[model samples]
Target: MKALVTGATGFIGSHLVEELVGQGYYVTCLVRGDSDLKWIENYPVKKILGDCLKHEILHKLTDEFDYVFHLAGLTKAANTNDFYSTNATGTENLIKNVIKYNKNVKRFVYISSLAVGGPSMDGVPLCPCSPPNPVSEYGRSKLQGEEAVIRQSDEIPVTIIRPPAVYGPRDRDFYMLFKMVKRGYLPYWGKSFYSFIYVEDLARGIANSVKTEKTIGKTYYLTDTETYSNEFLTDTIASELKCKYIKLRIPKSAIPFIANIIQKLTKTSIINSDKMTELKHTHWTCNCEDAVNDFSFKPEVTLREGIKWTANWYRLHKWL
Candidate 1:
């Protein structure tokens, strides 16, 4: 077996690469020239240096793989156009080139975001048929990317996985939560329910999608069986880290002002007014019944176990 992975240097992609290699597949990573290789430095996978939007690079990469995991995407940007250009347009470019060059590829797994499908109401897991109601520009762009993949599905075998708030070792986003817990404080804005998956479990689910016949031309939400409230998640992490924290729930009206200050201080769009809308959503759970039924995609890691493992990694790396 052979595979081509975009965004192979990222948190989820790096784990997927390791999973594929362990499964006896020869993997090739499509990464940007400046991508940090700390996660995959020891892997034996071949690296193809190029941007996904570059037609020649995509064409060349499409010629030599039996499977493609399209994970490269822009999650945060100062402008909305940047999101669409990289996530939506870049996905279209990769799929088109694959159709023209790699007809024998077994599957093209587009690793999409749960943001594209938005929140579920009242802790209900959003199913495949649920109408998309994206809250942020980043969510909208991801939806466009899903559409792009769907457009080429008739000609190329494609599967889409919408993963929710994934966390594990080597993950940077949720690392902040562990850090906050270590700092003896956790801030909450509003009550919300979220679905989460350990990164390794998510990678295993993606790898299984390739071998499962029913997954082609379908979308699945790869999440754990349970949904957790924001407060419960905070408490769980604090317990896992063996730390005590002053839990503060800021007023909803003050979040926008706080987000502005953080955005300015970090000089990053990750914490902006656009992201504030997503933070205020009440539910982010998704249904994984279809995945369980067809792909055997059962996520084995529990929240407590996952958090404990992640916290240990932080400690080992001297990050906490």
Candidate 2:
């Protein structure tokens, strides 16, 4: 089997690339000219240099592939237009080029976010059947990308995988928490609960979706079937760090004002008011029943085990 993976250098994408190579598949990585290729440097794969937003590049890159894993999208940006251009337009461009040129492509797996569904309306876990109520520009743009891909389901096999708070070794997003836990200070914002998936588990889920016939035209929420509170998460990290967990709970109302001041002065906003509001809203859990039933998806690593592995990686790399 031959496959093309976009965002091949990203946190989850890099892991997926490694898995694909290990499975003995001929993998082609679509990356920008300036992207760092250190992760997959040791792996044997074809590297195509081009930007996803460029039509000529997409036309050239979509030539011969059995599957396309559309994982390239902006996760965090200061400007909203950057999100729309990169996430929405980039996806449309890829789909258009694939339909026009790559007629033999059997599967197009899109790596979307759980944020696309926004917070749950009640205490119910977010499912594939819920209507999207995206709150941030990031979420909105991802939803737009999903719509674009779904429009091509008639001509191509498309599957969407929405993962929530993925973390594992070499993950920078959750590395901050590991650092805090190492320092014996674990801070949390709200009393809400959220779900997570190990990066390896998510990568395997994506690969399964590509190989499974029933996954086409379906959206799967790839997450653990466990919900954890912010306090519980902090404690787990602290336990893995072998430190006394010092919990610091700040008032939720003060996050916006502090975040705004930090944004104005340092031009670095860690957690904005809007993000805090989303955090306080809680119920960010997701149901993985569909993925499990269809693809035999099961998260191999427990939360504690994953955290220990992440903490060890951080220590070895001197990141903690």
Candidate 3:
């Protein structure tokens, strides 16, 4: 089996590449010329240099691959147009090329975000048929990307995986939580609760689902069935790091405002107003029954265990 993966250098994509390789698939990483390869440097995989939206470069991009995983997407931008340009148009371009050049590929798997489906009402896991109500431009663009892929499902086999807040070793976003815990502080914000998955668990779920018959034309939320509270998350890290922290619940609405102010002062896109749009929500859980029923997808790590492992990695790298 040959697997082609875009965004192969990213946190989740790197893990997926390793998973595919371990499963006896020859993997090819589709990465940009300037993309950093530090993450996948140890993996035995082939690399093709190109931009997804560059038609000439993406020609025959999926040739000879048994599966194609499209994980390349813009998660943050200084402006809204960049989000649509890369997430929506770039995704459309890649899928169109796949259908035209590699129609015989077994599956074109798209790794999407839970943000696309927005927050579940009253903190319940979302039903698969729940109407999409994307709260952020990032979510809206990703939904458009999902729509583009679903539109082409008739021409090529496709599976969409909407992964929740994923964290593990090599993950930067959640690393901040661990850092705060290490410093004897558990920053609390509102009643915000989330569904999360260990990155490896999500990668395994994606790798297993692609070839399965039922997942081909469907979308699945790859997440731990359990939803996590902010308190649980900070406490877990504090325990693993052998640290103590003061915990207090700040207003959830207050966090986005602070984040916006920080971004303005730093002029950094990382914590911009766009991301705050999604952060303002208190519930972001999703149902994983479709993935479970369709592909027997199971997460091997408990939150406690996953957090411990992440803690160990941070320590080893002197990041904690």
Candidate 4:
């Protein structure tokens, strides 16, 4: 099998590439010129330098790959349109080319996000058939990407995988809290319920979707089938780090100011006003029943075990 993966250097995408290669698939990765190659540099995969927004670059590829994993998209941006430009329009560009050229492609898997479906209704874990109500620009852009895959479902075989706040090694978002724990501060927002998946488990589920015949034209959430509260998250990290810390409760109203200060100082989107829109919600959980029944998708890593591994990796790499 031949697989073409976009966003191959990212946290999740790199793991997906590793999984695909382990499955004996010949892999080709589409990457940007400025993308960091440290994660995927040693992989036995071909890398093609290209930007997804540029149709000319994507058009140059031959129609030979058996599978296409479209994981390329902007999670944070300087402007709202940038998210749409890279996530939505870029997805459409790829899907169009796949239909125009890759006639033999068996599956075009779009790795989406739980944000695309918004928070669950009344703390109920959302299913694939739930109506979408994206709360942030990033979520809206990913929803657009999902729509492109669904809109062209009849034209080609495609599957969508929506993952929640994924965490594990090489993850920077969740690392903020871990860092706080290491610094003798345990920060938490609220008692809000949210879902998360280990990167390795998510990668396995994604690979299963690529190989399964039952996933065509279907959307699935690939979580660990657990909804964790903010308190639980803090407690887990605190226990893993074995730290003593002050309890810090971040006020939702102050997030915008903190976002500005962080962006100005670090120029990172780890915290942003738009992302706060999603954070303000009380529930962001989803179930993975469809994935469980269809492909026997099972998440082996629990929250505690995953946290231990993540903290260990950060320590070994001097990132903590």
TM-score of 4: 0.96
> Model 2, 96-172: lDDT tens per residue?
88889987789989999988988887878898998988887778999999999999999989999999889997787
Q: Give the per-residue lDDT of model 3 (tens digit) for 1-320.
A: 99999999999999999999999999999899899999999989999998888999988574699899999998877668988988999999999998888889899999888988998867788856788879999999999999999999899999988998999999877887788778776546565788999999999999999756988788889888898887788778888888899875667767777777877786645567877778777888998988888889999998999999998998899887
* Backbone clash count for every predicted candidate, in the order shown: 0, 0, 0, 0
Model 4 ranges off by over 4 Å: none
Order the numbered candidates by TM-score, best leading. 1, 4, 3, 2
Measured on C-alpha atoms, candidate 4 has an lDDT of: 0.88
Clashing pairs in 2: none
Badly placed stretches (over 4 Å) of model 2 are: 262-274
TM-scores of the candidates are 0.97, 0.95, 0.95, 0.96
Which is the better candidate, 1 or 3, if ranked by TM-score?
Answer: 1
Where in model 3 is the C-alpha error above 4 Å? 266-270
Cα lDDT, all candidates = 0.88, 0.84, 0.87, 0.88
Instruction: Score residue 151 of candidate 1 by CA lDDT.
Output: 92
Superposed on all Cα atoms, the candidates' RMSDs to the truth, in angstroms, are 1.3, 1.7, 1.6, 1.3
- In the range 185-210, model 1's lDDT, one tens digit per residue, is 87787678999999999999999998
